[model samples]
Target: MLDFTCGRAIAVARNEKLQPELLKVGELASRAGVTVRALHHYDRIGLLKPSARAASGYRLYDRADVARLHQVQALRRFGLPLAEIGVVLDQPDTRFAGIVAEQITALRRQIAQASALRGQLVQLQRQLQLGAEPDLANWLSTLELMGAYDSYFTKEELQRLPFFQFDSQRDGIWGRLVARIAALMAGGVPAASRQARHLALHWMRRLERDTAANPDFAIRMGALMEGEPSARQRIGITPELKQYVIDALAENRLRIYANYLDADELRRMREHGGKHGKQWMTLIAAVHQQMHAGAAPGDPAVQALTREWFALFRQGAGDNPATLAKMRLAIDSEPALLAGSWINAEMLAFIRQSAATLQAPR
Candidate 1:
């Protein structure tokens, strides 16, 4: 048998606008479905201070206290610590919407981590079920290997990684691009060839879009590839292809009025490259130079380059519909660009109009 007394008391408290003059600690706790000690702790922390104290020093909660307690419980569900909850609730300017947004982000990260762990566990289970001598040694080694790769990214960085969905209508254009690049590397294709230069341009454009969407994209990518010698070795990007990308980027850098490595810097870079597997270093240097070029502020050439890039993105709509949609949304949503240039209202309005036209049903 369950007592209806607490429910009735809460109903009364909820329905009535009047602040209760006094509430027995036990009764309040029963109505709130929490321990009396929990209520006491809330009061002690100045989170839910009672409206009044009786002669016997008993706590008496009011309507304001009930509201504050409700907020505390909601924040608790977000996994916020008691101390942090207090800070959040006490903040005068923090809106409920902001708190909700933060909680949503945290929930997404927790879900992603849980999903990764579940996948790993399922793999281990399958191995055991196969009657393969489930070597605890190998299992531990595998976990360590995974941890090393995962540790390169912070939780936030991992969340920001680009996720492109395959569209059947496009016939898996992105997958084809990946395969083409892999094949080019495998076939020892010259980087400076027309095909190789086109591929390099594709890669750079993709990278630029990614970096524009996620300011931390480059940082996270660098971290992920850091110290992963096997990964670079397996890719086997040839010297010719690397030089091709370097040359293409150098041309683009000049076009955008952006500086590439100076003679001394290039010499030092090449020297450093020679010491530590020059091929990967060269590719990385080319990408970095392109980034530097794109980073220049307030140059008319840079603005023209941006417009040209956007034009290229518009053309991509027919070739890669899913990517085009995403790019359109990002261009429309992102508030600013590389340097502090506010995306002008006229530009945004034009984008919206163009997007609508592009999205219209045939």
Candidate 2:
């Protein structure tokens, strides 16, 4: 606090005897662990100019300058840029506690981060010291993958993901899956077929399991894949491959839907789905949410969700008995036919049961 304000006035008024103890710039730089050039630059920047001049015209810094320099160095160690340091020093009216408190907060964060890093290094060293041999190439690959994850995942998310925390053969499993899919593509397997669809389902299930069924983490991962193409590339999932896989799943779902209803039904559904996409999204999200909350098919909330869903369906697919019958059959046939995600076997059964109960005599 004294370094920031009227301490200089007090010192000048009462400490004239200390004037003889002033040190030249070279001596001050030596004592302060800063370079003479740095001292001159500080003076040039009006940050820490010396207060005295000797008979030889050399710059002399007194105890007050040392106090000011100490504050400057403290801020420097906190990783603030020199320009910001100058602002803090020049604004004498600025509260000293605020400035130091900010630095203290930042330093504590930095110290925690450094400590985490030290823990990792120690763990690695302990493994080596215990004769756990490492492979050079694998270690580098791990580091590269780790950095890519850092670009997208938070600490909590990484902790939950199998790719970061679990010691399993999942990476090899993924590689084999990718290679098999590539082979199928080479053989000209249509993306809209049951075989390809099932593969896509497997792919999605594996990823969902890896994320521990955390829908939020899955959403974040999808955003990362969409927003950070380079990250996908590093992980060997190129944009073309990613689009092909996504299209495969989507087209397969539509194909399954068309198996019960006509192609025109799916076509009109897509068109109307575009116009009323937001409402559909909201409805689907609510249904999925209720499912996660342990609401059963007959729960009032779930019945309400199905009511909205059924109304939306009727709005798109006309109320003709045969048409409605086929739509119901489609809902019965395959869960993938539904538009929203996680509308798997259990969710589809629940949805159909709710729709049936709502439409029954009540």
Candidate 3:
């Protein structure tokens, strides 16, 4: 009986040893394109276990273990969350197609949100280039404003908007120039003075660079700015600052043009430029176009723009200074004279600078 029992035990041992060789956990992960940590997690959760253990006691797996890993990865790729994946792993035949469809839907939503975020960054980059120096706090807060735009535009659409179209370097320069103007204004600077007009002239050159003489975008952006007071405020666009800029630009324009006119002609211009101001508005738009197109100071296109502007001024002044000088005096004395105009200081400043070469010798 003892011999028979021992013989039976030896047979059992031989059968166990003859079983196919298994792979170590590291080897299995390498072959499967998965991490060893993942294998351990699966083992701990009783998900995929090694088929055996080597004599050295390391975990070992067989071909069946590899098949299980593939299933897990497939389900994951289909967008199955880990928790739900556990349940579906047991019955993949019923869940595979359904899970993949669900995952695709979720991925689309995530892509949309990411796209919106990307649009905001592009817009912000443009703003920064345009001369926005947002603080760290307001910088992030500005991104929150993206939600407001989502209702009206997609990321690609946002990039095409006027607010995002300025040349980035010039836009940045605009911010610094605005600071200088604001400082001068705050210190009681007088726009009629040569010093202030020079500052205004500096500002105009940058404005021309930013707008590239394109007013449509500038107009669109201005409307948005007026509509979004909070955004404007954060960027330092105060009414006082705006008014100061306007005053400075007008004064600078007058000074630069004064070089080309006599006292009588200047007097006539002031009257007509204000009286047929609607025509002046047309000239203003034309000037923007010239600036946007980067016409030379003496470009014929620019000459045509000035001719139109001069004609409007000549209309009211009777082709001479006449009552225009008094009109100027009145306009200068009252801030209210500037209140209802669409013209901005930045625009005037730009024209003043660009028209510099047209000035007659002193």
**C-alpha local distance difference test of each model:** 0.52, 0.68, 0.59
* TM-scores, each model vs. reference: 0.42, 0.46, 0.41
Question: Candidate 3: what lDDT?
Answer: 0.59
Estimate the TM-score for candidate 3. 0.41
Off by over 4 Å in 3: 1-141, 144-172, 271-362
Worst 10-residue lDDT window for candidate 1 reads 335-344
Expressed as tens digits, the lDDT of each residue in 213-277 for candidate 3 is: 34444444455556665457556767677667656766655554465556876665555444553
Provide the lDDT at 313 for model 2.
Answer: 71
For model 2, residues 1-362, the per-residue Cα lDDT tens digits are 22223222212223333344567777777767899999999999889988976555678777689888878988887788999988877775856566578778766656755764675576579889999875565556545655767877886567566655524367668787787777777788877766777777777777767766655556657666667655465456666666567667666666666777676777876555445544665676677778878888899989988888777777777666787787777766665554235455676677888878777411
Question: After superposition on all CA atoms, what RMSD does each candidate show versus the true structure?
Answer: 13.8, 12.7, 17.0
Prediction 1 global C-alpha lDDT? 0.52
Clashes in model 1: which pairs? 191-241
Q: Clashes in each model (backbone N, CA, C under 3 Å)? A: 1, 0, 13
Comparison by lDDT, 1 against 2, better one: 2
Higher-ranked by TM-score: 1 or 3: 1
